[model samples]
Target chain A: MKLSDLLETAREDAPAARYTVDDVVAAGRRRKRRRNTGWAIAALLAVFAVIGLPQLIARPAAPPATPPPPKAGPFDLLFSSYRSGDLRVGDPEWVSLTNQLASIGREVSPGVYRSVGRLVLYPAGSVPQTFWMSHPKEPAGAINGHEASFMPLGRSALIKADTLLTWRNADGSMVLMASFENRLSREEMVRLATAFRTTSPRPARLPFAISWVPSTMRLVAVDVSRPEAATALVTPDRPDIGFELEPLYEQAQFVSAWSEPGLNSAPQPIGLSFPRSTPGNASAPSGGIVIGVQRSFVSGTGPTPKCAPWSGQHNVRQCVAAPDASSNLVARAGHDVPQADLERVAAAGRIVGTPGDPEAWPTARESFPASAWVER
Target chain B: MSDKEAEFREFVGGQMEALRGLAYLTCGDWQLAEDAVLGALARLYGKWGRVENPQAYARSAVVRAAIDETRRPWWRREQSHGDAMPDIVARDEILNIDDRVHLRQALLRVPVKHRAVLVLRFLEGLSVPQTAAALRCPEGTVKAYTSRGLDTLRRILGADLSIDERLEARHEAV
Candidate 1:
């Protein structure tokens, strides 16, 4: 009984600790209020726009006496597939391409060639949808991986200026194989697949359309002019303009694994809001670009930003559509900075001047494609 | 003061240190235990009129809060807990400060729920029923946890230390 009494004394003698209930409660209240404010702002914007005059609405377009037929292209359908992070010589990287490109899962560029096509094996497995390069010649299947595993087929040439390998997609588009052979592998095919998987694409800024080629490794063609400029896409010869290359993310400060697997991220900043036009016309879509900083497990993958801020235009500014790829030919009102500054911003990741073959660089000029430039 | 508020103040004054002790055993860090208890008490104050027995309610709240903190974030762990076994002694040795501190460090490494049961059974002098009431568990659970906690404590602290030595270390710390 005496021992029991003493135990109570120890229990009751411990000192009480301190904390703020108000702070926790206050944080909760702040979160609730922020949600409420968001709803209120959305409602106010809706009401204000609704109350605006009929002057805000634009009239319909005058119908043409004879509508023109849809224009066909002199363009190559460029498909993009990549492996991100440290894809040692035998791993898989996720690959995504413009809907036009299909991963037929086999070495052959499907349908383009009859059964006489070359057979290629991919570490992503031998699926039938893995087709990319254009075919009509000798049977050759080229397998590569980047942000994910890919099984493309092609022949490649190395840029005499650098070790960057250039390959042709089965479809004749250009691709550059990034050199990230940091790990050892017993399987030759797996080693080749992994070498492809660890590569990253070039800087694809907004006001530009980046198309992929698999012939060489890590090459991208930028179309600042879109659809119409598709005809002006960069090729091995006959460049339409003189341009340069810049590097936004230096090659040394990169890791490949962080952007791998599902590439699952919280609300990606790279967004393409489809453009809107009047009832019959195409939509005029606009969006913002953010400076991207990519961290991964390899060296080849580099930084590419979307919609980086343009000088003087607090917001909306039109990208010029030059019929010919040479220099900026269009200008608009309310733009604060010179077109030259806008040109420099567009050149943010380029290396400048001709360093190698015109095919080695995705731009038509073999330096920087004027077709991909935006002006102030 | 209204009767409910006055009753709450008196009840809190009575249970404050005991609840703090329970929290300390759960979290091992005196500071975090204090925060857990104080937060629990303030919430108790808001429910002063409705609670049936504020002490038990607050004790349960402190235990739950301390456990949650242990799982989700840091609760100021004793760096020594992982390296050296907590100090414990045979029933024959004289209780000392060094032994008490080492024992407390080792006790902190035990599972928080297990430590709480040990504190309630031995440190608080709760009968099986009282400990169950405070923990909002059945008396059978209290007994099982008490047995398991003692076994784990003995295994962790070394077989030389007996229940009496642990009680004496508590006395030395006080």
Candidate 2:
């Protein structure tokens, strides 16, 4: 039997199957709409939080009897989860700098890492959650002409219970408070208070400002009151630089950022089990940021690689690269997807956009997305 | 939640089944697809009042929600909704069942770009132009995908698929 006859026979045999198309289409379209609405709502809430959050975040109208428990002293020189038994003898350089600050009452504690011996440098007597930095180390080899010096820490927000904040001094010496509740996680602030020989103290009103856009992984702002006010410096002695945050403040009306040099990124591949994704079979690199598909492809494996040669695997996939030159790549998109769905994620991005650099903006069309090749 | 929640619940009752089927096609996993549909319907329930094309809006919601559900870090920890092993032996019985399994297998083998087209064209019975309109792709792309999909299906189903292709040509001439 030919193709049409086969289809006709199939249709005659299973008239119900005809509905599968409409069913799948309707479901996909609704689901996508549902997701976009959720994201829009979530984003709106985030924006609202930014605007209306002042009230919630506003220091309590009635001050607490005692300020929250300050974080422990800067315990830089963190140990490796795989290697170290003690926090003192670790490899990360940020740990070393933190340890030096700790010698003089600076405070630093790990925020989020496997075995981070974090440091929170603080002034003589102040709240610990003031200034903060995760493993900040310089890039090895000939460094780029960028500042990796210290600036005073500014405002602090309790992103989590254990996490704290701190600021760098103008002399570029790290200073500020990092707070922690129990001992689960501590900030640099407690370390500073101890250095000043204070039993307990809570510093308030951060000395700086920082902002991040998920669309771009960059933080920009300045510590208006840093003591030394040196350029942000990078000093990764060996390979594998640690987290060094710098300002990328640009004077713009809409929104601008002070770019911190160096790309601080990890493989954020989302572990998506596409019907097409096989067991232990290599999947073509793919992923994209659509209106609703945040962290596409599941989050465990991390973000899909954007470029390099590869066949598109899943419709939900982002940027994909082929495994081989001739390995056939067959991207299977369901007919159910609305025309708008394809255009939603396939927007034409910049030829090359640098991460953390807001200037490298994605030229996205609000309505129709122009597809672009993502070959890194 | 007072009045709005009740109203949304009523609206969801109407759209749940259709949404679930669509979700199943998208993920190819029934339970996950149902969850995705529920999640989408729940969200739709929230905005039932403001939605213009409630059904269209719901459809979009399902597609995008399923997509996001695929993105979570925890999503990796989960895959199939059930542990039913694939039935390779009982796959090629009736053309419909065979077609479903065939399409599913071929779809799994096909790249996303082509698969979507196949689903839109063969399953959805959308004309090339309708598919282009639905996919927001150029007509050429719809045609290209149809051609490419047929070729890929040929490879996966081998001889079985060829007979079907010949049938399709005969039907088109008729």
Candidate 3:
């Protein structure tokens, strides 16, 4: 009748889970789609404000054509959903008095139309790249008879040699076209911008999933250029602690890897003994390391380990390896956290699935094979 | 099916029962417990790859979601329907069943924060710092809440014998 026993008894009569996995997945996808739609619209509006376009209440008449529009690109269908008056299309601060022109401005080429508050483009690829359209200090020039502003590609760390292209819409609205992956020259940028048409925004999906979130922590940002290497930033209610999760592709390589120089070089060895009595007791390598001021512990031969070692200069960390020797999970806390507590956190590690497919691990009480006693 | 989807389904299937139980213990209502667990699971599904410790994260999420449900206006409006205490026969049986029922009722009387601390610490076997981390509070707060919560439960149960002593005795008998 230990306290643990009482707690277990209290929950013995708990009801079964009513919802299925498919239901939860569906709900998650729906929520993500809604959030992505909002982001896409916001991005479109921000792009419009760069070139100094007036807000339009109604769709204006098409201007007289000067040149034939170019043929529609492969991605035209993806960009055709946006139109004028689609949720406050233009920003007031960007209104250009001198460049005020007819609404539904002339088509610079086939499939491309310049309107008061819209410039739609259908890029060929399905994958979206980060595009920056404006830099405050950059100089302006003319492209395809429209005043254009340009920013060098090296301006952003994520972009290499590409250039950002911005031009005034025929109705005086601004348009920007830039791609990090494809470096387009001034003429190509102009041609592509002139041949753009709006398409429906697709639902956004995260390449990776977060099976776990610390209590009181809200997911603030996600970086997923590669699904296997995705990272999630979570901010706790307390401002003092910062938490992030990144995949450890190879647990053994990391565990055996050399620690950074100029940091504490001493290896503080800690031991986690596996009890033979527990179910599914996998024989793991007995040794563990509590390295540096972070005190990150990496152990176990499991495929997917639950550990999150603080990436920065934090003094306390708990890293655990899965039973399969594939990936490691690292959790970092501030130096204020006691060493004993950090060990306990490390010992609490559980493996869900491989890095390629992260599932929720079984609870420690049910699946933690053998009681783990920490040895200093 | 995609590998990610298949993996997610396996995770959900394995952990659903435990999460539901934890949620039920925290919220004291089956329906709300289910809602809290499902909500947390849905969120976890969206973040499956980025989470480091999915079990810990799921537990923390379930607890927080349950706590959040109690604070809602609708949750507050619903009256708590207390469970009927089992009829006591032998003195030992009373100590086992009736005492548990009494302790549970006392737990509900404790403040939400204190109750959460008690449940996480005594029930989930989380360390002081781990409980603090899960609740997003300081270790000192967790220690204080634990002390106060146990005292409140002790008073509510109104047992002349120390609960610990009785539990120990019961264990030895078993």
lDDT winner, 2 or 3? 3
Residue by residue across A21-48, what tens digits does model 2's lDDT show?
Answer: 3343455457668789999999999998
Candidate with the greatest lDDT versus the true structure: 3
Give the C-alpha interface root-mean-square deviation per candidate.
6.6, 8.7, 3.3
Fold similarity of candidate 2's chain A to the true chain A, as a TM-score = 0.19
DockQ of each: 0.08, 0.05, 0.25
TM-score of chain A, every prediction, order shown: 0.22, 0.19, 0.29
Q: Candidate 3: where is the Cα deviation over 4 Å?
A: A48-376, B75-100, B159-174
Grade the docking of candidate 1.
incorrect
What does the lDDT read for residue A113 in candidate 1? 15
Query: Comparing 1 and 2 by DockQ, which wins?
Result: 1
**Best-fitting candidate, scored by DockQ:** 3
Is model 2 an incorrect, acceptable, medium or high docking prediction?
A: incorrect
Q: Cα deviation in Å at residue A136, candidate 1? A: 99
Worst 10 residues of 3 chain A by lDDT: A92-101
- What TM-score do all the candidates reach, one by one? 0.29, 0.28, 0.36
Weakest 10 consecutive residues of candidate 2 chain B by summed lDDT: B162-171
Model 2 / residue A341 / CA error / Å? 99
Model 3 lDDT per residue over A1-376, tens place: 2555656677775555568777878877887787789899888888776543554423356753544444432111223222222211111111110111011222334433332222222132222122343245255556556666766655334223345556654433344444333423455555555554433322212222234333443433222122222222333335443222111011111112112211212232222111110001111111112211112234543433344544433343444444224333343445444445434434444334343432332211122122221111
Model 3 residue A16 CA deviation in Å? 3.8
